[model samples]
Target: MKRKVVIAGGTGFIGQYFNDRLAKSGYEVHIISRLNNHIMWKDHHGIVAALDGADMLINLAGKSVNCRYTDKNKDEILKSRTETTKILSTAMLACENPPPLWINASTATIYRHAEDRPMTEAGGELGEGFSVDVGKAWEQAFFNFKLEGTRRVALRMAIVLGSGGGAIEPYQNMVRFGLGGKQGSGKQMFSWIHIEDLYRIVLFMRDHENLSGIFNASAPVPVSNSDMMASMRRAMNRKAGLPAAKWMLQMGAAALGTETELILKSRWVVPERLEQAGFKFQYETLDQALAEIVKS
Candidate 1:
């Protein structure tokens, strides 16, 4: 019998890519989304029925954290992640035959700002920002739940790189127009992972039952902000230098209800746990990842 997998946010960007990969890998894919109309799967259900009888459950349901974090936006951000996790946990507990593995999505911002040191899963301080607080609450909600038969894995992901919509496209456009430069002091660290690797890692974790805990889903080599911009410029073949000041980012992001911290904060994170598990990154260097994404 083909393995059956249920994806909660299968219609979204990352979820769609993951769903396609799983389908190609010979799994019976079932996608569940609030939106009834999805091209990936015809069988849709509310959160309640979505957790029924599956080998694995990958939860990617959450509002985009890149937006401005105003009071209203913050509420949406917190509720979107926490409430979704709660719903999924409740549903999983009620299932007659719950999935064996439940891979919940998380962010790397849970680590505190550490410019001089890299954050690892074993020993890293938690940041004190609103976003970090939200990440903690989101992870805690899942951790607190006691699903009798489901093994949980919380993935602390970094910025994902791909051809479609994301921070990369906007940065690429800026570099192409000769208006690209590092934001703020250009000293903060930017950890990232390619979409291909991210999708593969999710599948690997789902299949490996022993892999349960907080795994940082990021590339082994994390680059500084300045280095990242320089690489982007090299990829675009542009020599323009248009760096934005800290105040400018603050003013601009304020319109969207977010602060400048989203662009300025340092998250020097490394995938220590994943590496210990012998997961090799397909694109370890920024240039390699950028070239492939740009070409695609």
Candidate 2:
């Protein structure tokens, strides 16, 4: 029988990408999402059945943090992540033959905003505020589960760049429109990973049974906002672009219905554990990743 994989909340950008990869890799892909067509989140029995005898279970369920942080949005953001995770844990517990590997989604935003140094799994400092708190709670919910039969890994993913629709499109458009000079001081570090590499890390973790717990799913190379914008401009063949100041960014963010923190936060995260585990990134540099993405 072909290997089976279950993806909770697998209807978004990352999930769609992974679904294609899994299908090509000959694994039977299953999705438990909020959508009514497939197995819904409220359908507990369906989820239990999907988890049984699966190779891996990747939970990427959560509300998007791209909106204004209203009280209602914040509450939904926190509950969406923790509640879905709790449900998955219960489903895992009910599985007669649970997936050998369960990789829950996490964010690099868990680490404090640092212009000082790169945040590693062993050395990173946890940040405060709503975003950081959400990351903490999400991880806590996953780690709260104790199962001897299955290995649990929390993938602290950085901003994922890919040919498919993701955060890259908006940034690309910014660069094309000549507003890509750099937001804020432009000195803040921008940590990111190719979506392909992010996918590969999941396979590496699943194959390497010794690996568990937290792993920073970012590239070894992290560039600054200025450098990234420069690369974007080069990729798009734009010579000069305008810069957005902190106050300007605030107005722009409000108008766009998004948060400036997504652009302003200095996420200097590195995939130390993944590298130490001998996992190599296909696109190690921003230019390399951007080149591939822009062409596609």
Best by TM-score: 2
What are the per-residue Cα lDDT tens digits for candidate 1 across 160-223? 8887766587678767766689998999999999999998898778657788989999999999
Q: What lDDT score belongs to each candidate, Candidate 1 first?
A: 0.82, 0.93
Model 1: residues >4 Å from true position, as ranges? Answer: 38-50, 255-258
Q: Model 2 — which ten-residue stretch has the worst lDDT? A: 172-181
Clashes of 1: 5
Give the Å shift of residue 293 in candidate 1: 0.4
So what's the TM-score on candidate 2? 0.99
lDDT of 2 by residue, 182-264 (tens): 88999999999999999999999888999999999999999999999999999988889999899999998999999999999
